[model samples]
Target: MRLALVTGASRGIGRATALKLAQQGYRVAVNYRKRAQEAQQVVAAIREQGGDAFAVQADIADEAQVMALFQRLDEEDKPLGVLVNNAGILFTQCRVEDLSAERLQRVFATNVTGAFLCCREAVKRMATQHGGLGGAIINVSSAASRLGAPGEYVDYAASKGAMDALTKGLSLEVAAQGIRVNSVRPGFIYTEMHADGGEPGRVDRVAAMAGAIPMGRGGEAEEIAEAIVWLASEAASYVTGTFIDAAGGR
Candidate 1:
């Protein structure tokens, strides 16, 4: 079976992606930093579907833990075929001037540095230059990167912008080596992440703005997951260094 690893697979977009990939027949490695129970629940759900899955704990922001995550995979001796850098965080809405250095550091540490580190490892394993089979990487970015997310979390937007750059740059760097890199930018998805932004009902509060979107509604995690899975699948074999804006016509 092809092996796929998804970071922050405990919930939200990550969870949905994990389950979908499992259904698509990839033996999944569900990565979570904490939320062990939730991660295990995802594994259980995948297994219940007659799919192979295991949970691995790692703070992708921490280099050591990320290394350990790969170490565990090495011990299992599975050749990775797909990677979903879906782990990210969003702080409470605030202006750029109101944000502190620590907050910026924390946000970039996970959103930017974390994704970078994971991509580095995946490239080493999946790149033909490294004597391994080819694979695909799908970075979970945000439409906020394009909208600028003014007055909200510019830092988060900036971080995702960096992810977009990484997707393009890395796709070029590894295209000849059989690795495809892409991104999916989701907008106003109904996930608990808004609660982390200090408003559990933020999406509902912002629903009035849906008129600006051609679709006139917030998206769902599953919708984003479908795009992600397709990008990771062979149907997208000739696709690379591009992105799917799963945002509702934002």
Candidate 2:
């Protein structure tokens, strides 16, 4: 069976994507930093639907942890066919001047370095040059990358901007090797991530700040999951090095 790894799969977009990919016929490895029980719940839900899934714990920000995560998957003897670099974090509301170096480093550690490390391990297992079958990588970026996220989260925005660059560069680097890399930028999604930013109802509180999304509302995790699943599917066979913005037309 095909295998797919989704970071931060315990909740939010990651959870939704894991479920959707399972529906797409991929045996999922649900990776989470904490919330082991939540991750197990996701695995159980997939299995209940007659799909295969397993939960793995790892803090994507740590190189050693990332290696260990893949090592466990390697033991399974199944070739990885998909990777979703969806694990990320955001600090409370603050301006650049008020942000400290430590905060910046922490944000980039998980949002940027973490994704890079996961991609490196995945390429080793999926690249044809490494004697493995080719696969696809779907990055979970944010509209903040383009919007700059001004007062709220410039650090998070910058991290996503780097992710965007990685998507394009990696896509070209492995195109001939049969790997496709793409990203999805989700706008104001109704996820717990908002609470992580120090506001439980942040999206609802600021949805109008986008001027006006053509769809007239914030997106759902399932909506973004559809794009992620599509990018990992054969339907996107000829598509690579591109991105889909699920930001309600903002």
Candidate 3:
């Protein structure tokens, strides 16, 4: 069976993606940093639905833990066929000039460095010609990367911008080797991260602002998960290095 490794699968888009991939017939390795209970719940839900899934705990920012995650997958005879680098942290809204060094580093550690490390390990095992099997990597970025997030969260935007660049460069570098890299930039999805950011009502606010868009609403986690599932599937065999914007016209 094909295996999918999804970081930050405890909740929100990551959880939704894990469930979606399982539904698509991929045995899922659900990765979570701290919310062990929530992670286990995701696993339970998948099994209840008659899907194959297992929860693996790891802080994606730590290289050793990320390496061990893959090692465990190897031991299970479930070499990764798809990787969703969805584990990320968002800082409280702060202006660029007022950002703290600690806060900045923390964001980068989880949002940027974590994705890099996971992608590195995944590529090591996913290179078409060298690795046993060719696979796909889907980075969950944000539309804020393009919007710049202005007075709200420039640091978060910058980190996702870095992810966007990585997706493009890695896609070109590994396409010939049968590994496709792409990003799903969701615009204003309601997730736990927003609550952590001190604005649990942000999604409602965004929905009001979304009046300018044709769709007239914020995107849903399941909608974004659907796009991610498609990008990781064979249906997107010819697609790579592209950003699928799931923003409702944002």
Candidate 4:
């Protein structure tokens, strides 16, 4: 089976996708920045179910750390066929006037720049010209990219917009190289990420508001995972540079 690397695999969509990919027979590399314990648990759970997995650590925001991450995967002696760029960061609610340069830099560094580095590395390994067998890259964007996350998370929205552009540009670049690139945009998903926004119940709060979500409910991490896995699977072999909005009709 080919190996699939999932960044931020300690929890949320990343963890769910890691488990799902393992179920599909891919040896999973659960990458975590500081959540070693949770990452290990994911690996343990996969092993318990007769699936293969291992935990790897890296702070995607740092270029050195990102390089070390792919190097670690290189040591595994397995062909890397799938990469899930799921690691991202978001700060608490703040208006545009209150946004700090440091905050914007940090968010873009992780969500955009870091993802670029990961794709670069993955391409080096998965591109046919590089002697690789080719593969798929699934970037986890957000619905905020389209909705603009108006009052809050504007910076995050912009970063995801960049991710969308990256997915399109990179897909075309590697299309003939036997690689496919795509993205999944999830909206109001119930995950630990909401706590990062200083609102642990943000999803519920928004979904409760009149007409906030068309489906009248927040989405789940597993639902987003399914879209991501499909994009990385053979079923989407001919699909590239596309986005799956798994956002409950929002």
lDDT score for candidate 4 against the true structure: 0.96
Best by lDDT: 4
| Lowest-sum lDDT 10-residue window in model 4 | 69-78
Instruction: List TM-scores for all candidates, in order.
Output: 0.98, 0.98, 0.97, 0.99
TM-score result, candidate 2: 0.98
Assess candidate 3 and give its TM-score to the true structure: 0.97
lDDT: worst 10-residue window of model 3? 209-218
lDDT for model 3, please: 0.91
What C-alpha lDDT values do all the predictions have? 0.94, 0.94, 0.91, 0.96
Kindly list the per-residue Cα lDDT of model 4 for residues 198-235, writing each as its tens digit. 99999999999999899999999999999999999999
**Deviation in angstroms for 224 in model 2?**
0.1
Error of 3 at 138 (Å): 0.5
lDDT per residue (tens digit) for residues 1-250 in model 3:
8899999999999999999999999999999999999999999999999999999999988889988998988887766799999999987787889999999899999999999999888898888666558999999999889889898889999999999999999999999888999999998887888988789988778677636445877677999999999999999999999999888787
* Each candidate: RMSD: 0.9, 1.0, 1.1, 0.7
Which residue pairs collide in model 3, if any?
none
Error of 2 at 246 (Å): 0.5
Model 4 Cα shift for residue 233 (angstroms): 0.6
Distance (Å) between predicted and true CA of 21, model 2?
Answer: 0.7
After superposing candidate 1 on the true structure, give the runs of residues whose Cα lies further than 4 Å from its correct spot: none
Error of 2 at 235 (Å): 0.4
- For residue 188, give model 4's deviation from the true position in Å: 0.4
RMSD of model 4 against the true structure: 0.7
Worst 10 residues of 1 by lDDT: 204-213
